[model samples]
Target: MRLSGERLVEYGEKGGCFVKKMTADDIKDIRELRELLEVGALKILFSKNNKQTIKELELICEDFTSMVEKGYYGGACEADVKFHEKIIEATGNERLLQIYHNSNIPLFHLKLGNALSHMDDYKQTDVEHRRIVDYLKNGKLKESIDTLLEHLDRGEKESIEF
Candidate 1:
């Protein structure tokens, strides 16, 4: 919420646009946010740590995949949003969830418009999601963090037409 889309465009117009090279603290904050998003995206996309949630997310992913296959990108975008929301909710981190829900979450979902437009590239994201979840399952926090960063960067890139 700190920066608007028009503000971002203004920065681009002035050639000051970039997600900017993330600083250590920036990266730390983003990594924290990404962890929450990845957890949600993966939990909803592939279902991990809990069977019921997994089944539910699998069904949603299947439906969203079908929609994507049929060229209904909006639904895919919505499912992606729901996916992330579920993860944030699962975390029980109210403050983090607020940031995600109010700002980054919408931006991320918006990027899915581009990602779904280029399904092949986005497919890498899907696989990355699963990998992140696998890392979480195995208790590899660092690996999960790395993959989550990659996942977020990919979305950030695509969001700006990368």
Candidate 2:
């Protein structure tokens, strides 16, 4: 796991495995990597077909909003992952998608449960997700990426504090 760059786990030479504690720095590092991959994918997505992609993301945004409004944070997290994954998938680069999956970015929500515990943040997340989809539909790549970074940064802050 160490050789593969899995930060969540560590295997001791004494023949035991342990769950590695996540520090604030570790969360920050993961957030930075996520930003890089997601921003790069968004740039690539702009060069390709986005009509279908926009619709898919819009549907996800709706679901995410509904989940948040209903106070189902777990479901919201899943929808959040779907929304971001759709953006990455629209890039049409299999390797990029694979790297995103391997990075386990989706697990952050679970790992930092307190991050999404606030209703205010949930509402903000919904609004941000809708804005991202709208920006993409309007051919505003820069705005979409900017909103994405803002969204990720908010989560990172909450995670670190938690």
Model 1 residue 60 CA deviation in Å: 4.3
lDDT (10s digit) by residue, model 1, range 1-162:
255452322245656655533334543454456656665554443333554554555555566667667877777677666655665665555876787766554564555454447777546655765665567566566676688678777765654554
Per-residue alpha-carbon lDDT of model 2 for 1-162, expressed as tens digits?
653376667788997877677789888988998899999998998878579888989899889888878888888878888888888889999999999878877676465643457888778888998998788889898998999999999989988776
lDDT of 1: 0.58
Clashes of each: 1, 0
Candidate number of the best lDDT = 2
Residue pairs in clash, model 1: 40-87
Query: In terms of TM-score, which candidate is strongest?
Result: 2
Candidate 1 least-lDDT 10 residues: 1-10
- Alpha-carbon TM-score of each model against the true structure: 0.58, 0.87
lDDT, candidate 1, at 42: 49
